[model samples]
Target: MLYLVGLGLADEKDITLRGLETVKKCSKVYMEAYTSLLSFGLSSTGKSALENLYGKSIIVADREMVEEKADDILSEAQSSDVAFLVVGDSFGATTHTDLVVRAKKLGVDVKVVHNASVMNAIGVCGLQLYRYGETISIPFFTETWRPDSFYEKIRRNRTLGLHTLCLLDIRVKEPSLESLCRGKREYEPPRYMTINTAIEQLLEIEQNRGESAYSEDTTCVGLARVGSEDQVIVAGSMKQLLTIDFGPPLHCLVIVGDVHPVEKEMLEFYTFGKSSNQIS
Candidate 1:
């Protein structure tokens, strides 16, 4: 049997009871490391923390192993129990869905253990889940490639009075350009897009498009290390949020569209101001 388990956004303790039970029973356990990251991360120490708690040795699966070498994992599942751990909910990223499909094709029985992900955890900021429109991912811009495809999506959401959730980019173990050119494996340092960089990039896109998709004064919510003990959430305008340091990796930005009365009231609690740097 193949089990796809979600280890919520925080630390190893965030694993659900069922997920913990499944992991404890699995003969082979693999942690998907490329999609989304947890607050504690997957460093050797972090991995040991999870192992010490769950009492299972976990194999770290990068993009190359999961995408190009998934058959090896699936084949192992064909005989004994295997558990694939994801930072967020199993299906939060499309890659996990592909894994399930592949497993099913191989006649492997699959079960999913769900947990909190940014999709629902963002509601801690007080925005109604139903009020959110199409979610978009903002990738890091390069010198030659600056894509603004999310601009139209955000504009449409705002037009319909719905919030837009911008999932920032996370690059982990990415091969360096020199390595790719030299046909050798050399990884660059992992980069997590900050809320400040995201806002700057958004403004740059607007400056180029000149379509008024969103302005510097537009209201937004910046979230960092969500679900963790030291999680920080700040509500403010795009320009205002830029001045606040969200601290640490794994940050996300929410573009406010039409704020309901309750949402406004909740947002008021964390609104950017003198005491805006409060941590939960």
Candidate 2:
């Protein structure tokens, strides 16, 4: 049997009881490392912590292993129980869905164990989940490539008075372009986008588009290290949030749309100089 288990959002201890049981029973366990990450990150120390708790050695599966060599993992599951762990919920990223499809094509039985992800955890800031429109991902903007396709989506959501959740990009084990052309793979250092950088990029895009989808003075929420003990949530204008230090990786941004009375009351707790700012 092949099991795709979610490790939740914060740390190794965040794994659900069912996921822990499945991990303990599996002969081989692989942790998917590209999509998202826990508070402990992908360091050797973090891996060892998880291994100690699960009582099984885990193979860290990078993008190449998962995307190029997935068949080997599925083949192993064909005869023995194998566990594939994900940072958030099993289906948070589309890649996991593809994995399940491939496993099924190979006639491998699969089971999914679900857990909380940033998709829902953002509610801690008091924004109603139902009020959010299509979520968008903000990728790192290079000098030659600065895509603004997500601008239209955010514009539409704002027009309808719905909030927009912007998931920051995470680049891990990415091969350098020059090295790829040289026929020898050379990986660049991992990068996790910060809320400040995301806002700066958004403002630049808006400046170029001149559509006014959002502005520096627009009300927004910056979240960092969410679901962890040191999680920080600050509610303010984009300009104000830019000056504040979020102090960690795995940050996300929320552009407020139509604020209902109840949401306003809840958001008051997180507004600048309020009690929620003292949470961490």
Candidate 3:
């Protein structure tokens, strides 16, 4: 059996009781680290923390291992019970879906364990989950590649008065361009996008497109370190949020649309200097 488990959003302890049981019984445990991350990150200490709890040696699977060399893991699962863990819910990223497809072709049974993810956790901003449109991911702008494909989706969502959740890019262990040409891989340091950077990039795209999809004065909510003890949430216009700093990584942004009265009240609690407008 192949078990794909979600580790939730906070820490090692966030693993569900069933997930813990699956991990303990699995022949091998692999943690997929590229999509999203937990509060402490996958540092040495964090890896050790998971090992201590699972009572199993955890293998850190990078993008190369998971995307480029997934066969190794699948092969192991074919003969024995192997656990592939992910941050957030099991289906949060499409990569996991592909893995399941491959496993099925090989006649390997797959089990998914769901947990909290940004898709649903964004509700903390008070926006109705059902009112959210198709979610979009914003990639880092490269010198020759500034894609605005997500802009159209955001526009459509706003036209229907539905909120748009932006999942920022996270580059982990990405190979340097020059090294790729040299036939030897040299990875660049991991980078986690912040709410500030995401906003700046969004505004830049709007300027070039001039589509009026969204403006600097448009309302937005910046969330950082979500599900952690030090999680920070600030609600304000895009222009206002640009000047504000949300420290730490694992950030997400929400483009507000036609909000309900209750959502307005709930958002007011995190709005700067607007305590009187607290949510009822």
Candidate 4:
């Protein structure tokens, strides 16, 4: 049996009871490391933390192993119990969906254990989940390849008076262009996009597109280290948010479209000001 388990958002202890059970029962357990991450990330200590809890050795599966060499994992699942762990809900990223598809094609039994992810956790801000439109991801901008495809999605969501969630980019173990040119794979250090960079890139894109999908004065919520004990959430205009520093990695941004009375009230609690700089 192949079990895809969610480790929630914060730490190793965030694994659900059922997920832990599945992990304990599996012969091999692999954590997907490229998507979202827990507080300690995939460091040796973090892996050991999960090991201590589940009492099973954990394997950190990088992008290459999961994407290019998924066959080995799938083949292992064909005969023995295997647990594939993800930081957020199992289905938070589309890559996990593809894994399920491949497993099913191979006639492997699959089970999914769900947990909290950014999609639902953002409700802490009081925005009605039902009022949200299609979520969009903002990738890091390159000088030669500045992509603004998500701008249209945000615009459409705003037009319908629905909120838009902007998932920031996380580049992990990415091969540098120079190494690729030399036909050798040399990975650059992992980088997580801060709310500040996302806003700057958004503004740059808007300048090129000449459209008002969003503006500097547009209201947004910046989240840093979400689900962690030191999680920080600040609500303010894009201009204000860009000036502030949302410490650490694994940040996400929310673009407000039409704020409800309750949402506005909740947002007022974390609104940008002297008090917001302090930890919540």
Error of 3 at 153 (Å): 1.0
Q: lDDT by residue for model 1 over 1-280, one digit each (tens)? A: 9999999998888999999999999999999989874355457888999899888788989878899988999999999999999997899888899999999999999999999999999999999999999999999999999999999999999999899999999898899999999999999888989999999999999999999989999999999988888888998999999998888888999999899899998888888984444546
* Backbone clashes under 3 angstroms, per model: 0, 0, 0, 0
Model 3 Cα lDDT, one tens digit per residue, 126-237? 8899999999999999999999999999999999999999999999888999999999999988898888889999999999999999999999988887787677888899
Worst 10 residues of 1 by lDDT: 35-44
lDDT of each: 0.91, 0.90, 0.87, 0.87
lDDT of 4 by residue, 1-280 (tens): 8899999888888888889888999999999989975345567888888899988798888878898877889999999999999998999888999999999998998999999998998887768899899998999988788888888998899899888989999888899999999999999888889999999999988788877888999898888877878888888999999888888788889999798899888888878984344344
TM-scores for the candidates? 0.97, 0.97, 0.95, 0.96
Worst 10 residues of 4 by lDDT: 271-280
Badly placed stretches (over 4 Å) of model 4 are: 274-280
- Looking at model 2, the pairs that clash are none
Candidate 1 residue 261 Cα shift, in angstroms, is 0.9
By the TM-score metric, which is better: model 1 or model 3?
1
In model 1, what lDDT does residue 243 have? 96
lDDT of 2 by residue, 1-280 (tens): 8999999888888999999999999999999989875355488898899999998899989878999989999999999999999997899888899999999999999999999999998988889999999999999999899998999999999999999999999998899999999999999888899999999999999999999898888999888888988888988999989898888788999999999999898777788767344545
